[model samples]
Target chain A: MTIGLYAPGASALHRLPAGVKLGALVAASLALFAIPSTIVALAAVPVAFAVYLSTGLGLNRLILELRGPALLLCFVFVFHALAGSVEEGIAAVARFAALILLASAVTLTTPVSEMAALVERLLGPLEPLGVNPAKVGLAIALAIRFVPMIAEEYRQIREAQAARGLDRNLLALVVPLIIRTLKAADDLADAIEARGIET
Target chain B: MTRDVSTRDIVYIALFAALMAAVNLVPPIQVAFLPVPITAATLAVMLAGCLIGAKRGGLAILLFVLLVALGLPLLAGGRGGLSVFFGPTAGFILSWPVGAYVTGWLTEKNWPRMNAVWFFIFSVIGGIGVVYLIGIPWLALVAKLSLFDAAKGSLIFVPGDLVKAIAAAAIAETVRRAYPLMQAAR
Candidate 1:
């Protein structure tokens, strides 16, 4: 559930410009969609993995981190193949894998603070459009940070529900989760106000 | 009227993003008639939009999209990346922000009672329609099918999406009741 990439490295990849990395990621993604070749998409994988390894982020940890999604990706490939042709399925799988690898690299390399700062810088130009660039940037950063926390919260709720012998129905999961989320948001808003973050 | 987003807000956004990604890794529900499997990720998108408002909601989806772009299999049917955007479901994938924006915009409008009618309309027109607009054409192009055929393929999703819209609306209304401060902040 943790979306934050926790690679403890100070490599060059970690030092590259966030904007540049973002641009490259976007460009690579676009290339993936435009290029229909399964082979080319497959080729992007090792190259991405190479970049990951070059970062000195533990390859074993990286692989372990990716294992869950990798398994899921395999399932998708099989499902697609069963649903359609092998070529199309493989192409789909490759494109997906490339995207995952590239994003993991970005998250692993970029710290949250830097990411927030980068977002602020990126959105700075939008202020003229009546958009509060700082607020927007803050919101994005918060969203990134909270994603994992919420996942943990949901898991806790599920576990708690299971302890009570709840059948793990969607309602059982979603209801308590939503209630807790609202409570969390309330506590959060109060804490912010207490800190004078808001007038 | 301006309020600074705090650390907690950031944490909420990140947690929602991760939750969405995690849910997406779950197996998509296979239906006999539809080409695409039904996944709860869209529900997450709607929830993100309803809860986080427009900008953050959109950003949250962007984060999820970026995660997919990074090679995480955090998409419907455990699919991920830019390639999903080129597939038959690409339109829907792209429509996430639009859907969130529309839903958030409607919620922001602050209708009293927050009834199902407004919710249904906004979710269907703004949320679902935007998704189909982007998705149908892409599906048509990729599948090399006629516009009509592509539109037909999208039809399979209508019932399911309607259900999602209703659910999103319900969740949204419930949140509105539970968090009165959310409205005040707005």
Candidate 2:
């Protein structure tokens, strides 16, 4: 859930401009769509993982990070196989895995601060369109920061609900979470205003 | 009221984002009639808007997308990355912020206190329309189907999405009443 990239060392990949890394990801993604060989896409998985490891990022951490999606991929593959050809289904699954790993590498190398700065710079042209680059940058940064926080809060809420015997019911868990989140948002607004971030 | 962002506010934003991501980790609700799985993540997105208003709600979703893009399994069925954005379900992913914005905008405009009819209209036209507008075209492009076919496939989602929207409105209004601070934020 943590959206912040975590690269282990200061390396060339880490030093690269966020825009360049983002561009690389885009180009790689487009190229991935072009190549239909499921085998080649499957091969890219190890290569991407190698890249992550070579950069000093831990393999264990990466696997742990991928566990949730990996499980989801399994379900999708099963569903796809049931619905379509096994060959096509496996191919689709490989493609998805390859894309995720590659994208993760980019994120792992780039810091959130640099990402925000890059986004602001990219939006410079939008100033003429009446857009505020700083605001956009701040929004993106906060979003990145929020990913993990929301996840943790959900865990606590779920536990609380479970203890109260409400975990079995979907509405019981969801309603309280929503209410808590709304309350948090109001507090955030007050904080933002008080900080004079709006001004 | 005119003070800087407290540490608590920062914590709240972080908490909301994380919760949104966690919900994505849950198994999607399987629908017997459709290929698309029903997930509560959309409800979380709507909640973000209702609580944080348009700007931060949009920010929260953007964060969620970034996490997915970064290879976190923080999506329905635990899917993530740019590839997901190009798949059949991509449209729904993209429509998230727009849905949140619509929900927040409607709430801001006094729809929160209205009768069920207006509430239904506000939630549907605003929340569902935003999602469909982005989702339908993307589904068409990915599936290599005609617009009508794509629309038809997506139609299967309408009933479920409507349910989520109403749930969102009800939750939003209830919170607004329970915690006066929510309404006072605006």
lDDT for every model?
0.63, 0.62
Give candidate 2 regions above 4 Å deviation.
Answer: A1-16, A28-105, A108-114, A141-152, A170-172, A182-199, B1-19, B22-39, B48-60, B70-72, B86-88, B110-112, B115-121, B152-159
- State residue A1's C-alpha deviation in candidate 1, in Å: 11
TM-score of candidate 1 chain A against the true chain A: 0.69
Evaluated at residue A71, the lDDT of candidate 1 is 59
| CA lDDT for candidate 2 | 0.62
DockQ of 2: 0.21
Evaluate candidate 1 and give its CAPRI docking class based on DockQ: incorrect
RMSD of 2: 6.6
Give the per-residue lDDT digits (tens) of candidate 2, residues A142-170.
Answer: 65555456556767776787799765555
Minimum summed lDDT over a 10-residue window in model 1 chain A is located at A1-10
For each candidate, what's the DockQ? 0.20, 0.21
